[model samples]
Target: MNLNQYIDHTKLGPTVSLAQIDQLIAEAIKYQFKSVCVSPVWVKYAKEKLASTNVLVCTVVGFPHGTSTTKVKIYETKEAVKDGADEIDMVVHVADVKAQNKKAISKEIKGIVKAAAGRTVKVIIETAYLEKKEITSVSKLAIKAGAHFVKTSTGYAPSGANVTDVKLMKKVVGDAGEIKASGGIRSMEDAKAMIEAGATRLGTSSGVSLMEGEKINGNTTY
Candidate 1:
């Protein structure tokens, strides 16, 4: 497997610096990663840096916590797209999922999808905070709302992606949407397991290490 193609070479820490983003872009160019997932603030810079390459520029909306109002999330998506983001990874409101407010969840997702204006939008359900049934339900909502992918985590949660969650999401998404397994995936073994479970994309800060076959010990915030 060409693992690099599946990776969205990621770095989304709150305190990330310009130098770190430059390094991230350089590494992405070197490894030919599918994209570089950065914070919204760096979308323009990353896009400019990656203009000549096939690597896309991805950004997050509603982020680690999915409490932002739908209007705010839509504005974030528009601004990120204006700054040249090629893909958007958005967090869904877990409260709505818990409340079983399918209408609200669908509205929020559809709004963001419309704001994205045809760019790929991956909805992050932050599986760490949800029940299995909730995951399945929300993944269906995302697909119904026209999201291109249903993502596992934001990497800021207590835990991240797991094989079981990926498989469950895959079953729900089927061919209507794709799966992006993010967070806690630290090694080649972990990446392969996610893929086998039906993840077409991976959001990780350990892409280079995984490619080098080196497993580093620490928490990865992707």
Candidate 2:
């Protein structure tokens, strides 16, 4: 498959600068990646910079951690969509899954998805912190909650997306929603492996190097 089409060129570090956002937009446009994912604060700027292009502007809500209240996540989703984010990757509360609180999980996911209006909502289940059964369970809940996609990780976890996780997520989702494999995907081989395991999208801070068919080097902040 054409990998670029599935790549969501991302930079979600806490210390990202406007200059870096400019560089990210430039690289995204140059490489023709599907989208440029950033924090909510940069969504408008990224949207403006890429207004004349087909590249999408994506932003995160309740990022890195999914412990935010449902109300906060809903508000974040609305604000992100208002700020010109074409897609919202909202993290789901990991505690809900660990506690087996399916009702709360469903309620939270629904609230965020509803607040997104018509914008695409990708529910980040933070697979690294979940067991295999939790992965399948949450994937089903995401689909039932009206999420457009079920994402694998936040890239801030101890581990990120793996082929086995992707396969399990896809099996659970089963065309009900798309799967985005993210976090720690830093090479062409890793990207391909995720896609081969049924990832419709790949999120990485190493998009530039991966697109260039190289492994990321140095202490990158993504």
lDDT of 1 by residue, 90-203 (tens): 999999999899999999999999999999999999999999999999999999999999999998889999999999999999999999999998899999999999999999
lDDT, model 2: 0.88
All candidates: TM-score: 0.98, 0.96
CA-only RMSD, every prediction = 0.7, 1.3
RMSD of 1: 0.7
Provide backbone clash counts, one per model: 0, 0
lDDT of each: 0.94, 0.88
Model 1 segments more than 4 A misplaced: none
